[model samples]
Target chain A: MSAPAQERPHLLRIGDLARATGKSSRAIHLYEELGLLQPATRSSGGFRLYEPGAVERMRWIDLLHGLGFSLQEMRGVLENWWSSEQGPAAMEELRVLFQRKLEETRESIRRHRDLERELMEGLAYLETCRACATPAAPVKGCVHCTQDHGMKEEPALVAGIMTSPEPGHRSGRGSFVRVEDIG
Target chain B: MSAPAQERPHLLRIGDLARATGKSSRAIHLYEELGLLQPATRSSGGFRLYEPGAVERMRWIDLLHGLGFSLQEMRGVLENWWSSEQGPAAMEELRVLFQRKLEETRESIRRHRDLERELMEGLAYLETCRACATPAAPVKGCVHCTQDHGMKEEPALVAGIMTSPEPGHRSGRGSFVRVEDIG
Candidate 1:
């Protein structure tokens, strides 16, 4: 007597899977080798076939990968999903992990901001130096002055003074001149 | 007809500088070669001598190095300070540069946190799978059903189920099982 035939499970070819999961055929093959995924069956022509739920499984893997999980880590997670009897504990653990990661990210942001402040201050100094090279009389009664000397004077000390004039001035200078004061 | 005597600048020998700046004599020489610093003069015996302020400048360089600034960048900043007529402009440019570096560092930290989260989740799933390997009962309801019912049942259908029982199991033979009511 012939044995009764069983109903076949849902199956999809490699091309169909690639399109559905937005992954390349090569990547699918790689995942199978890593034991991260399994094909339901093979056709007479030796083409790989996936079951009905394979797409969902692939989606989960893709999401984890996007979140920076390694292929090995994803395999472990899938294994837990497949064999664990208590689902709540696993889900809880996952939530805790996410929270910890968020905290670390916030700390990193704080350190980066501190470094940013330091660099900004450095840049400000360069701008001030460039402005001083201009051939203008010192601002009289400016906030930088100790005394309120409002009267302007002629540029008599221009010869003795080591000046870093603006670009294209009479002195063909390559380097900036270190001057203690503009006046 | 002797020329008028020029005022001599204060100078420090290599060993004296090492003591003042807490740097090795070799390091001081390296700094001189890199142009990050300079000695005030050379002795008759070819020994190097530094000005009083040289130690202070070296200390500043050390500070910037600790903060992760490259020698080249430090040199550029120092050159600007030595040559620039305006201190404020140079400081401003430095501030902007620091801000850019801070942003890059923050991005790196964010990526690290994401990776950490993925790893933690993966580890949690592995733990649950290990717990569910031993079947508590002969045949429990489907794993998916248990997840929906809010019951803590052994994971039997999930992929990557642990083959060995967890530590401290009395019987240590059957699969870990926890059945939950689907309804």
Candidate 2:
């Protein structure tokens, strides 16, 4: 705050930029090669030096990655940004791309949610058989172990069916795909 | 249902299996090579023939993929099932692996949820500027455009700053990493 705007050290060394942005030195180099970043000037020692804002630019790159923009897509967004017309049409182009990404992320979330549910079902079925002390063949096939017993929860699978498949066995019984495969 | 199990024609050709499970014929061959699936029998013409149960098994494979289980990890899970002991310890190993997968899926969901929010904010901001009839430069820099227009939502980015960064400019203001980088 004490230094005048013109008096400030306007550019940062590559090391300083990397440290400030929390990116590894190699990632910064990769970003440069991808044309995502540029140096304000080179140091006397022939090092890449960045303007004050490069820190912010690199951070945007980080966020864009999380937003599901690949490096190529990120480059495209930056290149056509605000376009030459700088009007509503330019805005629409960005809007459409973001919209697609939003849907993709939503689909990913849904898939993970289903996977979590499947894992939970497998775990719960295992829990129900915790006290089982019967013979392996019968214990693995205990019909009671699959029943709700009294709780109105989802039925668990027979562990024997999951670990090893008997020929002609339908392993998809109570599988999540039964629900997902439906339109 | 009326036919005896022994009397029923139990094997399906590779094409029939592909159609039944909605997977490509190539995928079934890959699954067989991975040892995740096996044929009930082969046809006299050397075509692969599978039991009806393979359909459910393939469906499970599809679901497991969504859960982020790589082919190797999934193969390990199937191989370890029931292990040699066929006891509680064998079950515990499955539990631990499923538990890890559940956590991974939960994390993926969380990331997508955050991305969805960021995209929604960017879209809403663009919608606000949709009505502007002012000069391109001024409209792009308008402070009012960034401020909340009485809605109880997060403020939008400063328009000029988001849409156009001058050469050597940093645009990281209000970014997710601004929150993420702090702690």
Most DockQ-accurate candidate: 2
Interface RMSD of each: 14.9, 9.4
**Model 2 lDDT tens row, A61-177:** 877787667876776676666343654556666678777887987887777777777788878766755555543533235434444433464322223235325323232323222
Q: Taking the tens digit of each residue's C-alpha lDDT, what string does model 2 give over B33-114? A: 6767766554444455566767767777777777766766666666665243555555666667777877887888887887
Stretches of model 1 off by over 4 angstroms after superposition: A1-12, A19-22, A51-55, A105-183, B1-183
Worst 10 residues of 1 chain B by lDDT: B164-173
TM-score of 2: 0.70
Query: Deviation in angstroms for B145 in model 1?
Result: 4.2
The DockQ of each candidate is: 0.09, 0.20
Which whole-number lDDT from 0 to 100 does residue A158 have in model 1?
A: 13
Model 2 alpha-carbon miss at residue A9, Å: 3.7
Ten residues in sequence with the least summed lDDT for candidate 2 chain A = A173-182
